[model samples]
Target chain A: MKTTETPAPPPAEPGASVSEVAAPVAGPPRRKKEGAVLNVFSHGVLVIWAIMVVTPLLWAVMTSFKDDSSIFGSPWALPDRLHFGNWARAWTEANMSGYFLNTVLVVGGSLIGTLVLGSMAAYVLARFDFPGNRFIYYLFIGGMSFPIMLALVPLFYVVNNMGLLNTIHGLILVYIAYSLPFTVFFLTAFFRTLPTSVAEAAFVDGASHTRTFFQIMLPMAKPGLISVGIFNFLGQWNQYMLPTVLNTDPDKKVLTQGLVQLAVSQGYKGDWSGLFAGLVMAMLPVLGAYIIFQRQVVQGLTAGALK
Target chain B: MQHGKYRFIVGFLAVPLGLYALFVVWPFIQSIYYSFTDWTGLSPEFKMVGFDNYKRMLHDDIFWKSLQHSLLFALVLPIVTISLALFFAFMINVGGRRRRGGPAITGVRGSSFYKIVYFFPQVLSIAIVALLFQFAYNPDSGAINSFLRGIGLGHVQPLWLGDPSLALWCVMAVLVWSTTGFFVVLFSAGMASIPGELYEAALIDGASRATTFFRITLPLLWDTVQSGWVYMGILALGAESFAVVQIMTTGPGGPDYSTTVLVLYVYQKAFRDGQAAYATTIGVALLVVTLAFAAIVMRLGRRERLEF
Candidate 1:
């Protein structure tokens, strides 16, 4: 307990990384030798993990360009020549283009819906004092812990009864509904943190409640919106179970569902190279997005867990 | 001002709340009610059959197997993943040598690079990860067996997903591989908030690396660790496990039902077998297990919160 509450040291060294600062405190010579050996061991383990993570992904890309026989012949070898044709075959012939478009449509509609609806509810819950306010808030949050599969069971029939089982719009509505729990949970907390001064001032100027939320509060909540947006975007984009059960239409299949279906059906056709091409094609966009937005992605994901 | 306040609040909450009720809350309530009935989900007309499904679940071999596997997943995946994550986080954040002119603590060289690469799998869908590993675990032309034969382990060949004994562990390994990085990144963030002075104080006291970690870092990071446990356990028992098992295994949960979990069992029974009511029975059991797992972790991990 004594060690835990030690005050942060004065910033005697200004340019050091946030992770560690050279505390301007010296240690005995014995610690130096131990540090030297520990550095090597740490690097060794980190390097091994990095290798383990990258090798399979790289192998998938390599196999995508190889011919069928070569993929089986030398799993680790470079392709004899680049086969951009395999990608073409996957894109057009394997209907990956269709799956990609369906995914975009579903995730796009649902993301926008989730953000709008989630923020409205979050704003009201955060700002207003109303009847059953706590009840409504916990109702949204309780959805987070219960098994979605349990809901999904009756959800299937409800969707069917509503004539929403296999349609893109139906899928979008369900996505928004399921996504509401976390979105509201996150943004309600975010809304409460915003200084009430701005919104209160706007209310004093006689801006209607709806107008104030749309113009004033929404723009102010941009950072929180972006964080939870990225979270839902990735989740809805990679979704498989919902589509597998609900949207079983071949033409409406999302990327993850389509690829798994392809692997299962491609066994008879022996289009291993095309299948591998399709697999890598589905991975590149999100992987590239993460590389570009690496920092925000980590913050968005970790923030939910930390809270 | 007071005239429209209630109306405004109701208008704001209406759509999201209504959608949540229709899709999420209503279904959850209906499933619990369905669990005691005899609805096949084919025609959806049925009568209540009290405790029949529960009674059958007790005697059913497949139900027991799935329950056992689900329990294993919830128990083993968190321990293995979190421990590995904790070690890597320590190495990356606090394991560097105390350089002569540098801070008293630093991560090893290239910490950022390792972090970036380790996080690659977390972005990709688990379905994609499962598929990639499925090919790699191929007995004949897959990478693992090929590497083994390449290294003169020519006489040794193991059917990874094909053999029942090895199949479950292989599936769990994929979950661990795909998930550990997220926790590593999570723990790294937790460690970053710890003041450098604490570590400096420990170093000045002649404490070894392991001693400082167990004594200082672990206690400070306890809350994050506990929450991470619940998060990972819920994931292990939920859709993530369902994706890997359905995609990678032989019968999609078989080599004689070796890798089938409660989620997979629920899926198979409801969708494939047309036993929706019975599926809800199993799903209710799963809900019980999931909540129990979380409650247990929270109870066991309870400790004095260390303010820093």
Candidate 2:
């Protein structure tokens, strides 16, 4: 994926040099000719994979527009007409609007909280040569391997004790805790990559650690921050397990759990179309984010995963 | 000045550290403590169980079966997903060559499209994924059987999620499909950073494509592969079975507990069966298994950092 971003091709070989190589036993010419054919075959394979991957999603969208009968009767056919109202009904009838708002609140609050807290911790870890810095960093990174399910029983206890069950705030707090490790790990790498000169300059001036982080370091780390935010947003938005186990009240449900309820209620009755519609509706926010933040999210996933 | 710097560092570190301690660390400690005590989730009445839960867990067949399922998932998932991802990533990476008057075939036909397509499952909620697959794997009118019947392989269609023997494999297939794209994107990026000259040099030396791939590509790509392996292993241990069990299967894992995984059993024991302490013991068992798997993978598969 990153290879596609390089615009300049490798410097072209001189024409005479290419022709000199081409004169030998039809070797160079044959290789060059075969290269073209190989490229074509490569594209063919990719195109086929793309079609296979996209078909299910296309089926989903098409099914969303069909009535219940047409969905099974003509699975591959286009909707007789685009029932735009399924989307509308999905929103209003399913109370997807409330779920959407809950998702945004949960994702947004978690994103902001994760970035602020995670970046601050990353800054201290990366910049200061403090005692136990490595230990603290390890502590955060170790949290990465701690299964949320391990904490599930205890998390319920803690949240229930705090009277946070079913509240968006409770979900937000859990999201923050769950998200912190990756965010800190990624941001620490990002901060370390920053030329030390910038932070050193800030230190030489009267800028305090907090001021340097917020003013100079944060702006410089925009790409990293944006990438991390998009990753966290996707994680929180598509989240199912946390919300399912945390918030039981339908009114407090996020899009994920709401879609589950919609499926359970509608699926057995052969309401596949409605279920698909709800699925499509639930996918919109992440789809929008993907379209907007495609490059950064890919970069973040690459960098964070590889590190 | 030294005292002031110490104060400043302490102040900067306090909030996040405090939250982590309270929410993450303290809970971990409390979980360990709770595993040894008898406490129902709802009521305050409790007793010191004194390793009773763990001792019972040792003899419980279900507990062992769940552990085996989780271990099986962790072992198999990375191998299947990573191999497929590597293949796809290589295809997409090398696929795009400039053709006459096209808008840079890379974006339209190359890694970007692969990125988006593969990431579709990642963006959808797991509930949606499970439900979608539930219909896809439906015994009577599901897409898989329909496609099989449409082709000449009409006799080969199996009840995917319905058959106990096939259900676990069916769930694993969905997991592989959903996650392989994520690894493909990651591996492709890792592949991209390798200098093009290296491949050219190998080609110039009369190395076949297979030789170049095995010798140059796989060795250099080991770090990304290991990272994906460890991460997937941890997730496999924790949530892979939990998510599918919660969504698609019945309690105690499904179809005579063929799909019962450790976390789900813990969930059932804690919430459904009202055996909180026993369930906590199951969770601790899982925690131990995950840590052990992670440690082994990290130690054995550790690769030197790629400079590029």
Candidate 3:
């Protein structure tokens, strides 16, 4: 708010070399005869790995376009004609719509609750020296390593006791609760890295803490919020274990569970094309979101790990 | 002012704290308590059977087998995935040779392209990956066998996930395939953090690529690598191990329990077999082993971290 935003000055530490801070990437090294060979070798390996990552999805898509006979005939050939019916059959007959809707409601609700609650908690912990702040922070950190399976039997009953079993609300509450650790973990660290001067100015302007946070600080923390938001969106959207154990009604099943059931049934009944369609249906939205936020996906996963 | 500060803190903190306590922290405490009882999942009433479940676990062959699978997964997953992750990340970040006293090295020719492509599988739910692989592994029409036969190798094409002998390894291969990209991205970030001057200094000293990786990159990225190790290691034993198996395998564990992991065993017992107490018993043991494995790895992963 004070100075012109010219890419904010580099960190104020000595020996923070211009190249190290500014251009962390380096150019080509000095003479090394074997480097060309190594580059080829690296490309060879990466290309093969890339193919490994890609082929299955491609295979599934292509297979989805083919009927049973074509898929069974030539694994490598293009479909004689695209079969859009498989996708329609999957969306309607497989009950994927109901599941997709349930997932949308649960994940959408969980994301909002998690961001609001997590940011509030993160803000307080980052800004104030409250009693038990360290303890509360560690309490959240401690949940990160604890296996979800270890807590399953008891968590089942906890949700049940709260009368939230077999409901979207229950799933949302649990998702928000478990996601708190990760959400708080990243946001707390992120909040700490922000300059406190902005919030101080807000406070001096006669704003309440709530007003300061919602109007000033939260927006300043937008990049952090987005990173963690992207992280949570993918995670809760893909969440399987908690939802599987928690949300069990056939109509109430999330997309992952529904897709699993559809896949298993399709396999048993030999609806291979329909199975492929179901897989694609379950995959497209998440894939679209991932593509849009590809940079954030990389940033969030790495930061989440290191943090 | 003091009173207002306290109120502000409580106002901000109350909801998250209450929910965390109820859902995350409390379940852990309850699981420890539940492990000793004989409570079926549905029954409110049960008798306390002290250490009986643990005793049963000692004689339980399936329990032992599941643990072995988890141990095997924990061992093999990091060796294969992390090694590949480090290699790819190193190549992406430092494989290119650069001019002296110039900007940092470029990644491989198409680094961002490769990264996005590599990380494609990551966004999908594990169930989607599992199902995709399951179809790909189907002996009759699946991609693996079909491709193998198409390429003039019909005689050696094995039933991948269906064969009892190959089932477990096939499942682990899926885990590796789906997970490796994230680690690659992780290691690349760590690689990016290593300043340009160190590589230049090392180049001046004539360090080979392998030597630079093992000597410079690996040591500097040790801590970041350790957490990733702990993560990949614990995944071997987590409920996630169940998701793949449950989605991909024939039975819950399939082909005579070949792909059964500890978490699957717990899920089966608690959910299918209705042995909630015994499942919690297994869950407790899993908790101990996972934490211990993580602790031991982190302890060993500690080195005199370079502070450049």
Provide DockQ values for all models, in the order shown: 0.42, 0.34, 0.37
lDDT of 3 by residue, B1-308 (tens): 23378888999999999999999899889888888998998889988899998999999999988898888988898888899899999888888656446464567656787788878877888888988888678787767776677657678667888799999988988888988998998888888889988987887787888988988899988988888999898877785688898888888787888988889888899989999999999998888889998988877766345332
For model 1, what is the C-alpha lDDT against the true structure?
Answer: 0.89
For each candidate in the order shown, give its overall lDDT on alpha carbons: 0.89, 0.76, 0.83
The regions of model 3 sitting more than 4 angstroms off are A1-33, B1-3, B98-104, B304-308
lDDT of 1 by residue, A132-209 (tens): 999999999988888888888889999999999899999999999989999999999999999989887888899989
Put down candidate 1 lDDT per residue, B1-308, tens digits, no spaces. Answer: 46478989999988999999999999999999999999999995899999999999999999999999999999999999999899999988998766567888888767887788888888899999999999988889988887777767768678889989999999999999999999999999999999999999998788999999999999989999999999999999998999999999988899999999999999999999999999999999999999999898998886445333
Chain B TM-score for all candidates, comma-separated: 0.97, 0.89, 0.94
User: Interface RMSD in Å per candidate, to 1 decimal?
Assistant: 5.7, 5.3, 8.3
Per-residue accuracy of model 2 over A203-296 as CA lDDT, tens digit each: 7887876777789999999988988887887778778878878899999999888887887777566666767888877766666777677777
The regions of model 2 sitting more than 4 angstroms off are A1-45, A267-270, B1-3, B95-112, B152-156, B302-308
- Full candidate order by TM-score, most accurate first: 1, 3, 2
lDDT winner: 1
Best by TM-score: 1
Which of 2 and 3 is the better model by TM-score? Answer: 3
Sliding window of 10 residues with minimal summed lDDT for model 1 chain A? A1-10
Docking quality tier of model 2: acceptable
